[model samples]
Target: MGEAIIFKLHLVLGTTIFLLFPFTRLVHIFSGVAAPVKYILRRGYQIVRKRT
Candidate 1:
């Protein structure tokens, strides 16, 4: 119920999510990269083709 306890809980959960994000099926993690890369490569339209 204290501020310190809340901080600790957030730190723990954030660390866990950061550690697991890259190794799992949740690769929207890379959408951050895709957006910029799409601008340079002009590949924005290819996302659908690549997925199918």
Candidate 2:
């Protein structure tokens, strides 16, 4: 009985975190995953000039 209660609590907390993940700072995970793709498709580097 105790194990079943703990299992249910674990599932509830896991589902809550999954639902809230995208609304939290945790959403940055998607950005981090896409960064490499973005960099690969980005335009050429900017040219810099030295000031006299």
Candidate 3:
């Protein structure tokens, strides 16, 4: 019976974090980690034209 109570508490906390993850600053952590990999994988250098 005690183990079931602990399991329920874990489920509640996990659901809360999952729901709140997008609105919180915690999301920046994922973008910061992914940005470098995305840049590295992107194709081609940006073209810049000089004014005549």
- TM per prediction: 0.46, 0.50, 0.52
- Predicted candidate 2 versus true structure: per-residue lDDT over 1-52, tens digit per residue: 2568889999999999999887875454466778767766778778999999
Which scores greater on TM-score, model 2 or model 3? Answer: 3
For all candidates in order, the CA lDDT equals: 0.71, 0.77, 0.78
Range of the 10 consecutive residues with the lowest summed lDDT in candidate 2:
24-33
lDDT of 3 by residue, 1-52 (tens): 2578889999999999999989974564566768767756767778999999
**For candidate 3, what is the total of clashing residue pairs?**
0
lDDT of 1: 0.71
What's the CA error at residue 43 for candidate 1, in Å?
Answer: 23
- Would you list the rank order by lDDT, best first? 3, 2, 1
TM-score of 3: 0.52
lDDT of 1 at 11: 96
Candidate 1 per-residue C-alpha lDDT over 1-52 given as tens digits, one digit per residue, 9 for 90 to 100: 4579889999999999999888874654357867655555663444344555
Best by lDDT: 3
Q: Flag regions of model 1 displaced more than 4 Å.
A: 1-3, 28-52
